[model samples]
Target: MTLDEDDRQRRLPAGRKAQLAAYVAETGQVTVSALAERFGVSIDTIRRDLDQLSADGVLVRTYGGAVSQSTLSRVDRAVDVRLKMEEREKEKIAVLAASLVEDGSIVMINGGTTTLAVARNLRNHRDLTVVTNSLLVPPALSPSAVRDVYVFGGAVRTLTLATIGPVSFRASGGSELDISCDLALIGVGAVSTAAGYTTSNLAEAAMMREMISRAARVAILADSSKFGRRLFAQVSELGGADYLVTDSTPPPDLLEALAENEVELITPDTREGAPEADQDPQ
Candidate 1:
């Protein structure tokens, strides 16, 4: 260590850990090596600090370092990272979902990687109007593919690339043409019978609730991984959704609750890709 750094560490041992926690709070996330370099401490000491902070629920540890506990509780992940996961399942779900809408329908899609996949699948429909809050969706829908595309304007969430805040809500407010959607295709971070449906952002949840209220029918597009998990923000109850489209069946209890709520469950048809049972080996 530099002589200046060593002297500073010696003078403020307790203060250093406090400052480390403060740094993590300010930056949202940090790496062990970066923390070590900043504090002029050994990497092992930084690791110990992170561990203690995590144990106290002050922060949550990642593979390299730590992030604020609140960030972890929200279950937020970057859109790029999420897009790469459950690729095949999302594609199949999107295709099946696209089939449900008529050519001339007006559809609303909420912001999520899976819903973005759904937006992409609708490109072939020439007579549809696609309304969305996702910044990523507009570029994906060419004018020739859909007759009209409407996007809600608001503050953009950098991580998810979706528009949120009060402005977006106002744009879609009231029972008017803006919010008069035939169907809504929504995606969520987690779902449970007890917690209902939840996403990572509160603003997004608020927008989703309004979208659900305005739409004639609401369909939740979720992968099997989202089932049984509950995140920080509740978007709606089990009864809010009219349909659930997924790759596989959820837990029996949740399924029972969904059925009781009259939510239609749609799963991929297994026969589409299965080889014939009696097929001979080459």
Candidate 2:
């Protein structure tokens, strides 16, 4: 180590284990050498601390050092299983997402449990034009005051109970008109600052992108667990959407990334300065 670093280490405070955990949480992921130098300690000491933190479920151990448990990457689950997980958080996100839709606006919804809840939350909206590929979504809004519900015709994927195919429709005697919507609410499989938005299925990702293309405003509905996770197919890059609706604030790095993308983050605790979307959802 450098002589200055050695001197600095000697002056650092004790109670390193707790400090180490907090450090990991703040930075998201850290490497052994970097942490050691930052804390003015040996690499071996940092490794030991990381191991103990991993065992305690305080952090997730990685190849070089450790990643914060809160931002550790994850994967998609079965549709039914996903429906049961994070029910309340999803509902809150759904409610917030629904706030982005105006009463008479045409809105496009991508398929997912959270997006399904978003559809249900729109029950009070009237004269709404809805377009979607989700088989389940149409039924959710059937009893609502929605004026027209257009289900995209495509190959049905039983796993997600959604359709996957072309984004356009064909009529025997005529070509289709250009489609547009005011808002597009999408639920993704995984979301990370590095990978942006993604889903496990390629076709699903493509459909989501197409839906976003046809909308004037885009809101991504995801619970906090979806943060920092990446999947096989990318849907859009960071800043690709207008807003991110979640149950809680994202990690610092992710929060900054979303801000950089101009993606307004909306959570129960973060609605302070946000537009009263329901009042002027233009």
**Number of the top TM-score candidate:** 2
Looking at model 1, the pairs that clash are none
Q: CA RMSD for every model?
A: 9.4, 13.2
For model 1, where is the 10-residue window of minimal lDDT?
Answer: 273-282
lDDT of 1 by residue, 1-282 (tens): 787875586347676877888888988879999998888789999898888877776777776787764454346676754664677788777876776677888888888888877777775577888888898888866466688887887889988899885423343456434347789888888889999999877899998888888789899889998899988899899899988888888999999999999999877753265221221221
CA displacement after TM-score superposition, residue 18 of candidate 2 (Å): 36
- TM-score to native of every candidate shown: 0.67, 0.69
Worst 10 residues of 2 by lDDT: 273-282
Q: After superposition, how far is residue 32 of candidate 1 from its true place, in Å?
A: 18
Q: Write the per-residue lDDT of candidate 2 for residues 1-282, one digit (tens) a residue.
A: 687765654445445777778878999878999998977779998888888887787887766777776664435444664564677888788778877889999999988899988887787689999999999898888456699998888899887889998677767767876788999999987789999998888889999999989889998888888799888999998788999889899999999999888999889887654333232221
What shift in Å separates residue 116 of candidate 2 from its native position after superposition?
0.6
> CA shift at 183, candidate 1, in angstroms?
0.5
